[model samples]
Structure formats: structure tokens, C-alpha cells
Target: MSGHACGSLRHACAALAVLASIGAGTAAAQQISPAETLLFETEHLARVRVPATLVYAFRKESNVEPGFKDEVRLELAKVNGKLNATLHFLTGVHKQDIPALEEAHGNPVLLGFLEHDIAEMKRLTGGSTAYFRKRIRMALAEGAQVSLQPITYQGKTVQAQAVRIQPYLNDPMHARFEKYLRKTYTFILSEQVPGSLYQLHSSLGKPETVRTGTQPADAPVIDETLTLISVTPKQP
Candidate 1:
């Protein structure tokens, strides 16, 4: 073959290879699902830096309690690869001073409660450890759901995921409490930053009828909301 023809053929082959490479890359990107992408992003964020701090502001409102409002500040940090959180209640009926708590202990009050219950279950079912373990695993699996969504924060649209966790209360007393009580918690977490939370809102209370009338046999009397107003990253 002529040298010119050979050169042209080689160039064509090179172009085809480049196009094939591009096609493969596009296919791989398409194969990544949203959940997988989020997991990858969060995991990447987690490994980025240690001892990072996040700050948030909280607000609480209640319908039954007239003129009821609560303000607080929250700080979340990762220290030595462990998570720590502190809650500072500014003004509220259930106001109190809380010291820094480790994540294992569920730093936030509700999280602490969950951790406590799980620990109690482990202690109680020492003989049937596997059974209890399985129960807890199944409960978590059933209660947890995640979805990719967009949120507006600080005048910018950012990608986020809504994580809903509603573990089953096996304790008879706890079940009784939920029977007549209503509770909701919303946590706003960043998709790009692992362990970074923008907001958390919790609302729990009894119905108006229960509040006005005689208390039911087993009804939890509680009303409150906790919100995260802002998050500021702290230098290591």
C-alpha cells in the first residue's frame, strides 16, 4: 500500500479507538445508579479530612403550648475518626445544658435514646444474642429508606438525600407510647460532604383530644421540634 494510504488508515484507526474509549466511559457513568453515586460521594467525603466541625442552629415550635419557641445551637465534629455532637438549648420549656457526647451514645437526645434501647436489648438477650441481632438488623432494614432529592440552602440549589429511619419499638411501653403519640424527624444532610448535616427537625406530641381530656391508658405527653439553622465547617 502507498505510504499516504497507510497513514490515512492509521489515523482512521486512531480516531475509532478514541471514539470507543469515549463510548465506554459514557456507558460506565450511566451504569452508576443515584444511590451508588451518593454512597461513593459520601464515602469520599468521609475520607477527606478528620476533625472537621459543623455548626447548626435549631428552632422549635409547638401548637398546644401558646407562645412556645425554642432556639439552640449544634456542633458536630469528627475527632480521631469518631463522631461527636453537642446540643445547646437556648430557650424552651425543656431547656437544659448538655455536655459534648460521643456518637456511639447517640449525642442528640433521641439518638441517645435509641442507642440506650439497643444496648438494653443486647444486655437482656445475652442467651439469644443471634436472635436479637437479627431482630435489630431486620428492624433497621425495614425502617430505613433513602432517596436522592434537591434542596435549597443559602440561596443555592444543592443535591441531598432524605434518609428516613423509624426503628420498631419492641418494648411494650415504647409501643404504647407511640400508639397515641405522633412524632416526626427530618434530617437535612449534604450529598457532597460526608457526616455534614444542614438541619434536623423533630416534632413530637400528643393529639389535642388527649391533651384536653383524660390521659389514655398509655399515651406519651411530649411536644417539641429541633431544627438545624446553619452549618459552618471548622478547620482541623
Candidate 2:
């Protein structure tokens, strides 16, 4: 359990469940009923899937002259749901700013609570409204995406307001992403077994763009690949 804060990113991330709720109205009504409870279960699962560490590589290429490449690896953890522990490295360096990486880890209390929280999620999966809402609120308090200004749920239309983050994060080239950089998504959660609903969706996040060569100088296009990674119950 890494320590991190649940910020606009986590909030936005937590809101991803909204997409999973697409076909979930019926099951929720029959069992959960309360919106809070549904959200709680959703958040619990989300937390589990949060990557303890992430590694990404980016290389620079030239249209006319191609050869130089650079890659970066980032180790991430959560602190109250927001990204906390993050170690950034620029590949070639063996021991870069490792202290800063360790500093970015997470809070102990938050990690401890997650264990109990997940247990509660299992208990409340088919439980009551109060239990569900309590957990959901806890998750939301960490700051989840309230964007969309409001959306439709269980036949009722509701609006969700967006929270602001640094605008630079929204830029794909930067480290932090602002609220506006979020991808548009649609989700549908349906019960496969009598009491369980499997959620699925078409996530509309940024499409990856690959350019080779120096910037400001019409970088040559090398290759572009846009792949979709689907989420399964166990994987989530």
C-alpha cells in the first residue's frame, strides 16, 4: 500500500466508475439502492487497481536524421488517493534523485486504512445504503473527478462539477494533468451473476502521438499506434 493523496486525478479517476455504472441501475436498485453504497464498492475496487509503481519510456527521433532516444521511468504510490510517492528517472542515470522518490511515497495511516476499507467493500458489496454511502463519501472526500457538470444515472440525470488542477498537467508533455485533460468515457456495469455486476466501457482518453526529431523544427513522423487496453473484473 503506497502512500499518495486523492486529488483531482484520483477524483477524476474515481469518477471512472460512473462510466461503469451505465447498465448498473437495475442491479443497484434491487440491491444497493443508495447511490453512496454503489459508489463505495466502485471506489474500493478502484483503489486496489491503483498502480503501486508506473514505468513509461519516451524517445526523441528526427524525421530526416533519426538516432537519439530518451526514456523516463516513474514510480508512483498513493497518499489519500492523490499521487504521493513518485520517483522520476531519466534512464541513463543509475542513482538519480532517489531521495526525492522516497519522499514522494505515501502516508502510513492512509495505507493502513485501505486494508480495512477494502474489507468493508467486500462486506458491503451486497449490503445496505448507509454503509455504501459512508465509504463513497470517504473516497470522494479525497477529491475525485466531479466533472461532466452532471450526467445521467439510473434513469435520473445528475450533474457533476469539475474540479480544477494545474493547467499544465493537462498537457500530455507535462507531468501533472489538469482537470480539463481528462478523457471522455461511457461505462455500463451489469450483473453477470445474480448479485454481481461486471462493468465495461469505452474510455475516451488522449490518443497517443509519436513524433520523431527536434521540436520547433517540424519533427518528422515516425510511427503512431493507438491501442485500447480493456479492463476485466479481476484485472481491476
Candidate 3:
């Protein structure tokens, strides 16, 4: 009952800042794009009520390796009146170290996903972790494309933004993983959504096979997404 709805486009523009706490360079130092602001700087989770569980359905499919149908759970709660989060990035036997996020940092989902993705890239490509990390950071900071979009939330249409990028296409070392050159990412965010993030999608392989989504693992490509499937009051 506390969050505003249907207008994140304007809220993002109004909330613009370098948000250096998340490693944003000062505004005077360089040009930061809207993609960067929304992804790294905006408080995406502040509006979701404390004691809520934001459930994201994580689906990954690939012809080259084993795939998974899993979930990412964000347990949101209050700590001294400020929002806090615990990200369960992976559960069950493959569980990762629990990440207790910064108080009111507001975008833990993005942080957690990219961290896991970077590791996956390195594991699959035999690439340096630093390379994947830096390229992704640079793309968001200055190179991604942004567009206004409409998204559905609770049966109503609302304004949102989609930020798209392919960070490896121009990398000098990209030939190291030739087939991955066309990897692209799309992230959709809307204020009307409980946690602001509507979806995070990553596509890899030929354009033809890249469009494969959640249910199709038999394709010769890799497709993955973390979609905001539900949000509900947490059991106390």
C-alpha cells in the first residue's frame, strides 16, 4: 500500500544521480546513461513493503550443457526502518553463499543476477572473470540502448523502460569465445511492478536460435531469464 504505481519512467528521470555508493563515478567525471542510472543507482526495491517475498522464476536452457528450472528468492524486511534484503541466488544443492545486501540499496536482484551470470560466462567460455565483469559494467555505464515500453502489472498497463546491450561484440578479446559475440541482454523495469524489475533476459547463439525461451532447452542455443513471477506478504 505504500508504493506508487504506473509511472516509473518519470520517477527514474527525477531520481537521477551518480549513486556512487554502488560504484557510479561522479557525475562530473563521465557521462552515465539512463540504463546505468536505473540499473545501478535507482532504489528499485524501496517501494515494496517490508516482509514481502519477491519470487523470480529463473529458467536457463542450453544445447551445449545441462539446463535448469529454478528460482531466485528475495526476502525483504525492515532493519531499523530501512529496507534490507537477503538474496537466495541459488537454492538446493548448488546454493551459493547467502548475500545479505546493503541497507536500502534497492537493487539486489540486479546485483545478484549479474554476479551469477559473470561466473557462468567464465565457466563456459574459459574467459577471465575480470574481462566479463568489466565489459558488462562498461556497457551499462555508457553503451546500452534504452527505450520506452509498456508493461502489464496487476492487469493494468504501465510505463516501463527496456535497456538492451551486447557487451562483448566489440571487445578486443572477443574472439576467445567466437560464438558468444552475439550475446545480448534485455532488462525491463517498471515502477508499477512490486520490485521494479519486470524481467532480465539473456540470449546467446544465432539470431534464429536466440529467441528460444523458458520451455525450449533442446535448441542449439542458450536462453535464460529471471522473470518477476510473484510477490506476496512474507510469513512472519
Candidate 4:
């Protein structure tokens, strides 16, 4: 459960600096091409069982920010086969991984702030929707603005934006709450290049040091068909 998702947050933050460097370097960008195959470097943090939540942090070759970079932490709650999830994404000036990196390297207060934030996340999502919604609703009601956007992914287009109210919000244990954060960000990609992949070169969890030449065992295995699923582009 903790295998992939748990480490995504850590890896996302670590890769941000490298990604920024690549973005600023023409050579790095040039080496990456639409015909050269695109890779998605991603890490997953946390997994959900019933009312489960999965979080992913990744960087893609194409997006509003090519070499687009950001960390999106998502929490999903499920019940009776219905699923609702919330997403919190940090971008540009509000990016969390980079700032967390700054703190992890030198700022103690930033580290503390991060720890506090994660703890709150865990607390809010630790139980079923019933156990968490009222608290979530109250939090959202506290003046947080909800924004929605249209996104196309997997050949299907849907509104991808921050949503409140999800799977476990109605659990008896969470009745004091009135809302929960539920959102999913969707990506629309077409013409994927083959052989490009985002892989972990090494993990302290394993004996390998971070190396660039070989594939990491934990890298995602994308079936060719799955990659082709639901991809469309607007006519120029």
C-alpha cells in the first residue's frame, strides 16, 4: 500500500530542481522532442483501501508548461462503489516540492511547516467520508474558493478541478464535518513517443545509488495499448 504512492511526494520534490535546470537549458530541451518519445517522471505517495486515497507527483514533456512541473497531492474516499477525490496542486510561485526542498536543505521552520501540513492531511483523511466531511466542509466553508476547469484525458473530456464532498464524508465518526476536499486533475496527451520513460535510477531503499544509465525496477510499466487509450488533439 505504501509502496509507490508514499514515495511519490519525496521523489517529486527531489526531481523539481533537476527539472527546473532542464527547463532553463536549451540543450536539455532540445534533447527532448515530440518525435523522440516522451517520458513521464512520476512518484506515488499513499494508497487507499476503502475510501482509499492515492497521490501522484509527476512532470511531463508537454503541458501548459512544457517540461511542465508541479506536485499534485490527491486524496480519494470510496464507498458502495462510488468514488470521490480531492486534489491540492502547487504550481509556479505556490509550488510545494521546491519550497519543501529549500526547507529540507536549510530552513528548519519550513520543515516544521511541511510536517504540520502533512499531519493535517493525514488527520483529515485518516477515516471514512462520514468521519471527515463535516470537518472538510467546515474548512472549505471557511472562505476557500472552489475553482473548476475543463480537461480532456483518455479521449474523454471532463471537468477537472477542485471538488468538495467525497466518499467517506458521511461516516458516523466524521459527522461533525460538513465537507471534504475532492478533486482530480486530468491531462490530455496525443502522439506519445516510444521508449521515453521516467524511471528511478536508484533508491536508498535499495542498494543502488541514483544512476542515469539504467532503468529503475520501480518504474511504471505502461502497456502500449494503455498509452494509446483516449488520446485526441484539436485540429490546427
Q: Report the error of model 2 at residue 186, Å.
A: 19
Q: Output the number of the TM-score-best candidate.
A: 3
TM-score of 1: 0.44
Full-model lDDT, candidate 4: 0.27
lDDT of 1 by residue, 93-171 (tens): 4455555655322224333222333343445334233333333333323344566668776666888776544333442
Better candidate number, 2 or 3, judged by TM-score: 3
Error of 1 at 100 (Å): 2.3
Better of 2 and 4 by TM-score: 2
- The predictions' CA RMSDs to the true structure, in order, are 17.2, 17.6, 7.3, 22.5
- Tens-place lDDT digits, model 3, residues 50-162: 78998999988777777788898888888887677888887886465544754645567776677677778888878876677767766776679999999876667899999
Model 2 lDDT at residue 110: 20
Against the true structure, whose lDDT is highest? 3
Residue 80 miss distance in model 1 (angstroms): 9.9
What C-alpha lDDT do the candidate models reach, one value each? 0.40, 0.29, 0.71, 0.27
How much does candidate 3 score in TM-score? 0.80
Residue-pair clashes per prediction, in order, are: 1, 33, 0, 34
Candidates, ranked, lDDT? 3, 1, 2, 4
- Quick one: ranking by TM-score, best first? 3, 1, 2, 4
In model 3, which runs have C-alpha deviations exceeding 4 angstroms? 1-28, 206-220, 234-236
Q: What shift in Å separates residue 118 of candidate 3 from its native position after superposition?
A: 0.5
TM-scores for every candidate against the unseen true structure? 0.44, 0.23, 0.80, 0.21
What clash pairs does model 1 have? 57-229
